[model samples]
Structure formats: structure tokens, C-alpha cells
Target: MRIRYLLLDVDGVMTDGTLYFDENGREIKGFSIYDGHGIRLLQKARIGVGIISGRSSTVVAWRAKELGIEDVHQGSRDKEAAYEMIKAKHRLQDEAVAFIGDDLIDLTLLRRVGFSIAVASAVDAVKQEVDWVTKKKGGEGAVREVIDFILSAQASHTKTPFS
Candidate 1:
């Protein structure tokens, strides 16, 4: 399958599944710079990026904007619906999509996409279903690893300018 779009799940897939709350009762999420650059790299390659997460966080929106990810669907319990929206939005087929996730909730979308991936620390069930499992944990360069894989898969055909 030729992956043209990369769909991501936050929380366990992007971060280490850790949630923090400050004294002000404000929620905080941590994102890795490596993942940020990975998003940028994908953007440079003209590959589409989308996020379908079950939780809705202001930080997630801000981070997506920072990384130039335009297709973000938050608070989506039924992720397959979100995936369909992206597929229609991009006019892409399931065989051209890659989804990376880490939990049971992500399994539905994972199974439907062409290339499903999981981070090294992902749940056993999720790892079992994925076509590829990264060596790094979430928010610790897992997304970057996937980006590299996609780019490498198309390397011979397209010379993407990666610095």
C-alpha cells in the first residue's frame, strides 16, 4: 500500500500518556520537538497529516497549528468517522493512508487504514495489529520514526529534500 496521508492519535500516541494539572487546575500536555520537526518534514514532502484524538485540548489545537497540521479532529470517540472525513477531505483511499495509534480505542481506525503503526510502548493488542512498531516511545520521537519510514518508503521514487 502506498501511504500518502499520515493520521495520528494524541495522548498515548503522541505523548507518554501522562496528563498533568497545575495548581490552577489547568491541563497541560507535553510534545516533543522531534515530533514537531517530523511533522514539518512530512509537510515538506507534500504528504498530508491529520490528527484524530478522543480528547479535546486547547494545547492540541495550538500544537497542530504550530506544526502546520490542518486536519485535526478532536473529541472523536468514533475515530473511524474522523478517518472517513479525512479520506474525503483529501480525496484519498484507505490504501494510501497510514495511521499511528497506541490504545484499544485506536484499534478501529488502525484496522481500517492501510498501514497501521504503534509506538514501542504501545499496548500489546495495538502492537499486535500494527504493520510497524517504532523503537521509541510516544512523544519521544515515535512520530519522527514513522515519518522517516514513510519518507524512506518513497525515497527511490521521490527525492524529498531532507536536511
Candidate 2:
């Protein structure tokens, strides 16, 4: 199936799943420049990107804005509901959506999406459930790898400047 939309999980899929707290009890998350570029590539190819995270963080909002991703849903324990809402909002079919996740909470959406991806550092169960397991770990170019795979599959890169 052709994928029209891509959904990502922030903690484990975009970040290294590490939570850092400052002395003031503020959160700090590290995001990859490669992942940000990959998101831009997807947008250039007309594929929509969105984020659905179980935890709420201001850093997530900042990163999404930096990437120009408007569909951001944070603190969502029920990712499946968010997935359905995104699908409905975009009027996309089940077979037209791809999701990458890393934990047990992401299972339902992973099982339901057309293309299911798991980061290399993901838990065994998650790896076993995905259609593809990224060679690169999360927050370490895993998202870029997935983007290259999709662009290659769709031949979208043929028209991009990178080609």
C-alpha cells in the first residue's frame, strides 16, 4: 500500500528515550538534525508528518514547530485514538498511513497502520511486530533511514533536489 501520512512517537522513536531534569525540574530532550531534515524531505515529497507522544513536553512543541509539523499530540496515553483522529482528519485510509513506534503503548497503532516501523533500540516485542526495524537507533538517524526508505519506495526522491 502507498503511504500518505507518517506518524511518529517522540520519546523512543524521535529521542533516545532519555528524560533529563534540570535543577529547576525542567525537561530537556535532544532531537537529531538528521531527523529534522528527514521530516523536511517528507514534507517536500508531500507526505504529512505528525507526532503523538505519551508524555507532555515543551521541547516537543518547540521541535515540532521547528520542523513545521502542525499535527502534534502530546501527553496522549491512548495513541490509538490520536491515530484514528489523524487518519480521519486527513481522510486517509488505514492502508495509506505509516507509523513508527518503540514501546508496548504503540502496539495497537503499529498493528493497524499499513507500514509499521520500529527503531533498532526498540523492545523485542516491538521489533517483532514491525514491518521494518531500522538499522539506526532512535534519535540517531533512525527517522532519516525510514524517510529514505519511504522516499525510495514512493520514488518521491526522483523529483527532489537530493536526487
Q: Output the number of the lDDT-best candidate.
A: 2
> Which lDDT tens digits does candidate 2 get at residues 19-123?
999999999999999999999999998999999999999999999998999999999999878888898899988888888899999999999988889999999
Q: Would you estimate the TM-scores of all the predictions?
A: 0.94, 0.94
Q: Could you give candidate 1's per-residue lDDT for residues 66-107 as a string of tens digits?
A: 888899999999898888889998999887888999999999
lDDT of 2 at 88: 88
lDDT of model 2 at position 149: 89
* Candidate 1: residue 133 Cα off by (Å): 0.8
> Which runs in model 2 stand beyond 4 Å of their true positions?
156-163
**Clash list (residue pairs), candidate 2:** none
Assess candidate 1 and give its TM-score to the true structure. Answer: 0.94
Model 1 misplaced stretches (Cα beyond 4 Å): 157-163
